[model samples]
Target: MSKSVDRKMSRGPSTEDIIEDTLPSTTETTVDKIEEISSLEKKLVRKIDLRLIPWLAILYLMLSLDRNNIGNARLGGLEKDLHLEGNDYYTALTIFFAGYVIFHIPSNLVVKRLRPSFWIAFTMVMWGICSLCQAFTHNAAGLIACRFFLGTFETGVGPSIPLVLSFWYQRDELALRVAIYFGSSTCAGAFAGAIAYGVLATMDGAHGIAGWRWIFIVEAIPTIILGLLSLVIMPDLPSSPNKRWLTPEERELAIQRTEMSGNTDKQFFDKKQFVAALTDLKNWLAVGIYVGLNVALGSYAVFLPTIIRDMGFASLDAQLLSIPPYVAACCLVFLISWNSDRTMERGFHIMGVSSLGALGYIFLLASESVGLRYTGAILVACGIYPIIPLTLSWVSNNQLGHTKRAVAIALVSMIAQVFAIVGTQVYRTEDGPRFIRGHAVCLAFISLSGISACVLRILLKRENTRRNQTYGPADVKDLSTLEDIDTLYDNHPQFRYAL
Candidate 1:
């Protein structure tokens, strides 16, 4: 858990308060809030939106499926199969995150430069191949190597997907869409368990390898196939598309819309702009929020199935039962996103959801009733999944320039994932069967998140008021261009930060 630290610099202006005051009052009006949707001419946005979700979802699904199949594998004797002892499995988990942190920033930069279609698909194939290699692990060293490569390949996909969504959708439309994409990861969690159950039921001892190996091998094949297919179907970008896939009219509309919003430019790396982005205290604040949330999330990801198995279900049945929490999460994600979009509010929605998650963890920590614990599981599934996408959309929407947004997104994501290493350690197998320590840890983190969301909202509100007083007019256009505004907010009068 985190304590409040006043990071105010004594010599300089209260940058925190200044940052708070920079949000535009125009953004606070109900009429302005309702306008995130396009005009009637573009009413078919949902139809096209539907097409985009499956590819993004499938991509995330496989990414999660492969990464977490280890939980299911653990049930099928993976530890024994690979002769793991002490903390070898936890070490493998930590190694994946180490590789994950190493590649995340560069991978995001590549996604910003190259086509998402090609680069993301390439990442998919690479991770899928590594996941398949997991099936061949005969020792701790082999598993570690495979997991490292798997993490290196999959590192970017999580951050890249939100970056890609920010490009196409407005701030309002993005939250729900992001939830849909992120929700798929929860679905993958469920699907992986269910699929693993099926795989184990039929092929327990059939292969030269164990049933755990079959889970990895079979799950991996679809990922590889999907990766290759994505190269063909994935949209390149709003600016540079495979001309064959889009009509000239659609391309023009994309460019024109971005220009109308005063943000049409390719993101390029610049040393000065990068430094300004890094310097913003809010950037680091956002990272802190995510790190706490992720530590809780990662604990659930790596240990929930194991926890269930300890609760009297057989190994296979434990795997099968893991499906419901994630399935419920998928539906809750869409519901929460829609509500957030309709209300055009991010902070409250996030606080509310995270609070629910904290409550779930508290329930698990306090009670021993199986039925009550199962309910807590459902609450955990629904509550945590929405925060990620909402938080991501909030960060991306508030950031002004393309280059700054790119780096900021990568930084938050990478910093958050660093906690995955911490999380993997917190929920050790020895803590199973009502992992009291694990539950308490997650509860503490979720409480931190609830507190942070309040801080961010208050900061945003104060900033919006200050911007109103300073700017003189809500419709000022002189500092509106992306290039001009890029460095203007760094103690400069010309730029205004968005809330």
Candidate 2:
């Protein structure tokens, strides 16, 4: 008996072991059969990216070109031609924001009420007309009128993009998509330089038109054409019936992917969320971050060529040198946003970059080295540009409902545009070359931005930690119903801020 038992044990369970090995366990089959939903999301995201990003990027490129061309036009002797004296030039720059700031909230709400494609495209054509009008201006008052209307129509595109992207992309995916189109604004800077050089150099006297006027005409036509093209290309929100491009299955997946991230409300307008957006502390904090960025951004856009010209370069060389900083900005904007998305982090990236912007101003204020000051200019662009998208996406990320997100995005934009108003005023005609006051003001605000970002991050992290412990870390499945989801908003114990 002992010999038989020893032989059986030595054979390692004999036939039973072989039989069990031949058949997979329940766990193994489940593991093998389990579907990867994220792969489908990637496919859908790629599809959305293809259909959306390119056209939007082109539109933004033109929008930015049209918006920032005034600065480039200044180099082409726009002020002298228009007889803009004293603060008149700054007033023209500042008035655009008046319309821009006033219309932001209304336009965002209007976007919700109208089909996004129709609304956005309509604005594009209108703004192009306004931009075209700038070419016909004979005085500062005429230019200011064109600029104000340009800002009014242009508002429907620039600040509204993040809100539109939010409807399609999840928080995890929002930043990069925001960067791509927004980054084109930086590309617009590069293009602005290159185009200004081209228009001023060759078209100075063409068709009996001044080169500055030529700049407006050349940039405005493409905008109108692209606007018409967008009707055929621009997509509506996934839930919108206008989304003919999406199949039923893919569309559902698109909606589902976004739903997994947060509230995917069916309503185009939510009064409650609108009220919440107005009242939310986060929106105001986001405004602070943006105020800082806009001050730097506004000054940088309108004054760079002048600053470079004051640095002893010829006007054309100054235009050419402006191209490099914008080129660097284009690269850094994409990389920073890519990394922000990759890590699912917003604040530290914002804080770090704002500090980098402040340091750039430091370089400007601290040293008179042409090389150092120029490098400071580059650093400022590299630093300031990335934060715009990051902060917009951050506000959009935290807001739970469509209306809230939309309203919050606009509110933050509306308030922040005021600083851009200040930005135009910062680099006064007298403050050429060093522009110590302008540089110092930028340094202070940008530094405030970095600090604000740090504090916001710490506060968000603490809230997230508290929720994780108390509510036990909610996931997509936690709030089982739409009612449950809508009511909770940010207060939902499971909702975590994208820190």
Candidate 3:
């Protein structure tokens, strides 16, 4: 059972005040930590954030552009140029997720095996090359091949990011960092629109190439440059022995933090943990949520420009209009994630947003009025985009060991990428102008996500309660003396899952 760690200089120090002061300040702390986060840990976290997040954010933005710019390109005449019709465009889109799903587990394992810096940077360069190749593709097969390889190479970075960030950040600190990383997608969405508008306006006829080709070339080059920069700039794992960027004390503390929370032993391959990940119910629940998100996201990324243009705007106006929703989405992503971290709450926030997103789809499906339908798009962006980091952080928060966490991350990601494949194929050109079927399917899935969050929260809460009854409430004071901890993991009596 747990007891309070009260430092009362005055007789009047309330129990609530002790709890408040003892809670994490600006530093990283474990679930049952007695002291506030130290200034040293806070400084180390800030240093890691500064050294790691910006370059990661930039590259993530480029990745989003390279992956989702196809919608923008289509508006700039990619379809006509490539002779894509009927199911050809959908096939190209589907191929990306096919490779994305196939490579998730393998890519994550490779990153764990090799140096994080080299592995991530290498994949970034490869994906950049694949993105560049898309600009030159003359037919469906060429585009599909390029897209497939692009997804394959990108698997190294995107799916493993939360898992990677988990190494450097604690459960308390990770949601916001992950949110910041995921926010790049919204920025890229906005940026993609603005860039497409500019390219279509200025570069369509220059060098006798289509504006869509120019879009690919412009986006691909920067990704390549950023990839090269990553070799020098990217931070390796916190547990890695050699960190030239960190001081000796800071590096020691960084490594210590990993071991402090639930015994994250340094094993690249733990078969027992891998098996645990394979059988975990929580991973599958997360997969449902992620699949719901990607279902909406895939359609939104690939079809938003077309949707806007279909709403009676010119192609250029549609491109320009697309930027606002993404900008709005990016802002909300920050606000929601910050609140989620501040309160240390996950499930309810995810539930609220997914429900709101489903309502947005309802508005879209029910309305023939163009203004109302556009409002629906804004609501959907605001609602759906924020759930991404929330869900990923929750998944990361629950897992115990490094290998189990890594495997769990990859497992959920691979399954979600399966639905991501479905996400691209849901939108048919026949249902175009107002793609009712895609909107309906997205609505159903988003609703499923909200319901799943509620159910999973209940399940986890019940399990935690049962643990308290059976094992006793988790006590921080008692936990420091724990031995042979690696074998127990989440089974350890003191380990608590964050709700």
- Candidate 1 lDDT over 174-256, as tens digits, reads 78888888889998988888888898988978847689999999999999999999888887666775655445755654544
Model 2, residue 464: C-alpha shift (Å): 1.1
* TM-score to true structure, per model: 0.88, 0.92, 0.91
Model 2, residue 471: displacement in angstroms?
1.7
Which digits, one per residue and each the tens of the lDDT, describe model 3 over residues 247-287?
A: 89788777666555553576778888888888888888888
Task: Please give the distance, in angstroms, between residue 61's alpha carbon in candidate 2 and its true position after superposition.
Answer: 1.0
Select the stronger candidate by lDDT from 1 and 3.
3
**Model 2 misplacement above 4 A:** 1-38, 242-244, 478-483
Give model 3's TM-score versus the native structure: 0.91
lDDT of each: 0.74, 0.83, 0.81
lDDT of predicted model 1 = 0.74
